[model samples]
Target: MIDTHTHLYSEQFNEDLAEVVERAKSQGVEKFFLPAIDSETHEKMLQLEAAYPNEMFAMMGLHPCSVQPDTWEQELALVKSYLDKRSFCAIGEIGIDLYWDKTTLDIQVQAFEQQIDWAIERDIPIVIHTRESFPETFEVLKRKKHPKLRGILHCFSGTLEDAQTAIDLGFLLGIGGVVTFKNGKIDRFLNEIPLENIVLETDSPYLAPVPHRGKRNESAYTSLVLGKLVDIYQKDFREIEEITTQNALRVFGMK
Candidate 1:
């Protein structure tokens, strides 16, 4: 399985990174896609990728929460510089996150649009992180809608209507630990959304699935997410992995 979204560079794993990867690999999670948080952590993310090579793919972008009014432009310049220097799996974990601070909405929108412009121009995929701003995120996608504009709604937490809307916009729902929550609700109607429009993630060190809900999440926990899908979709585990892995490959342009 491919953990399409994760933060293996997070300090939480600094003590035993190899052990974590080994644990994940033991669970059949062979590929991991890491998202850049900002200029501060981009180096760390790249270092982790270099350490693992193809096992760990890196993405470049300024996370919305990191978009400060004083330095967002400078950070975005760094993002552009990196994209020009090398390739990334996607320009992501980028989008508006109003849950933390609504005041930065204007700047967040600009950064989101600018980064999305980079993705469209480069013909690369984007991984969106919409929080408490689903409609607003969709608005940006609607405005920037193009045949070449495609990506994932990373850590998607919206209604069934929102799922269909994202799919309609040529995006996939990033299914993760949230679907395993008793109140995550997405599980109720997840089967309704075609598996083809879905991809698996853990959002590790963040939304760990049940049985480890409050604990620190690792890539291996992706199997738990997949297990939930198996129950929800009522399909075999191998079939679910095959389809979701294909979805991740398609979104990341991995072939």
Candidate 2:
């Protein structure tokens, strides 16, 4: 299985990073896709990817919540510099987040559009992070619609209409531990959207699945998310695993 989004570089795992990865591997997780938060976390992310080159892949971008008015442009420049220097799986973890602070919405939109342009130019996917701003996110997507504008909506917890819109926009819904939550609602209409438009992710170091919810999430808990999908789709475990793994590989443009 593949954990499409996990912050294994997070300081929360500083002491037991190795054990976490091992435990995840033991659960049959073969690869982890690490999303960048900002300049501050980039090095740690890179270091983690370097430590496990074959298992961990890194993406480059500026996260919405990190878009401070003063440093956003400089941060974006730094992201561009990194992109110019090396290849990344995607340009991602980028989008608007009104949940934290609505004051920066304007700059957030600018940063989001800029990164979307970068992803299009690079002909790569862009893993989006939208929080309490799906309308705003979709607006940007609609305006910037391109043949190459494709990605996964990370931690998708939106409505059926939103899911259909994302699918219509050439994006996939990233299913994470939220589906296991009693009030996560997405599970109710998930079957309406084909499994082909879905991908599995842990969003780890956050949103751990049931029995482990409200605790530090890990890639191993991805299995729990998959188990939930099995119930939602009524498909066999191996089938859901194979399909979602393939979906993740497709998003990253991996073989």
Cand. 2 TM to true fold? 0.99
lDDT of 1 by residue, 138-172 (tens): 99999999999999998888999999999999998
**Candidate 1, 218: how far from true, in Å?**
0.4
Q: All candidates' lDDT scores? A: 0.94, 0.95
**lDDT at position 255, candidate 2:** 64
Question: In candidate 2, where is summed lDDT lowest over 10 consecutive residues?
Answer: 246-255
Residue 251 deviation, candidate 2, in Å?
1.5
Clashing pairs in 1: none
Give candidate 2's error at residue 119 in angstroms. 0.5
Off by over 4 Å in 1: none
TM-score of every model versus the real structure: 0.99, 0.99
Candidate 2's residue-wise lDDT over 1-255, tens digit each?
999999999999999999999999999999999999998999999999999999999999999999999999999999999999999999989999999899999999999999999999999999999999999999999999999999999999999999999999999999999999999999899989888898889898999888888999999998999999989889999999999898999888996
